[model samples]
Target: MTDIIEAIERVNGVLVDLSLEAFENDWQRQWLVERGVEIISEASRHLPDDLKARNPEIPWQKVAGIGNVLRHNYENIAAAVLWKLAQADLSTLEKACRSELAAEQSRGRR
Candidate 1:
């Protein structure tokens, strides 16, 4: 759970600096978009199965798959798609992570 939170935080941090203009710059694409996806993927892998099941709205497998593609299919990845993910999809994931973390904290207090 802590790992997931940290991962989500890392992703959010990367996203803060990303923009569609980043696609025009190789360094930003690698460091921000690609790396952010890698972090999310790795963090998603650590999530407990039940926790993942609880958030069916998130495409957990697809999130993990992005990590795989980044790692293995780097040359084939489309900059436009990566840009879209960084700009749009990650917010949904971040919201889900924050919600789960809040729920977990509340449960711990009881």
Candidate 2:
């Protein structure tokens, strides 16, 4: 659906924004990581459990963990961890989102 696609686009846009060097500095990284967490939470909320299960390529738990960290323990959140997530996990998440969208579209057609 268009809604899912829109959500993916929004997530990608924020990911792109966060990937920029300006967002990497200590002054801005936490805010960017928070924003990243927000984007992942919004996008993940749109995905049905069945779809998520079918697509094991996505790290759903980690996606949810961002919100948990930001909400409950943000004061002790680590920059290195956030940076590692940005570098390591975001692309996989983005790809999984696109794949799920495609699968949903195919299911609708059938």
Candidate No. with top lDDT: 1
lDDT of 2 by residue, 19-56 (tens): 44554465554565566566676667667788778778
CA-RMSD of model 1: 2.3
Per-model TM-score, in order, reads 0.81, 0.67
Cα error of candidate 1 at position 77, Å:
1.4
Q: What value does the lDDT take at residue 83 in candidate 1?
A: 66
Scored by TM-score, the top model is 1
Q: Candidate 1 on 1-110: residue-level lDDT in tens?
A: 55555665665666566565654566663556577678778878889899889889989999988888899988887777776776678778888888888998999999
Q: What TM-score does candidate 2 reach? A: 0.67
**Pairs of residues at least 3 apart in sequence or in different chains that clash in candidate 1:** none
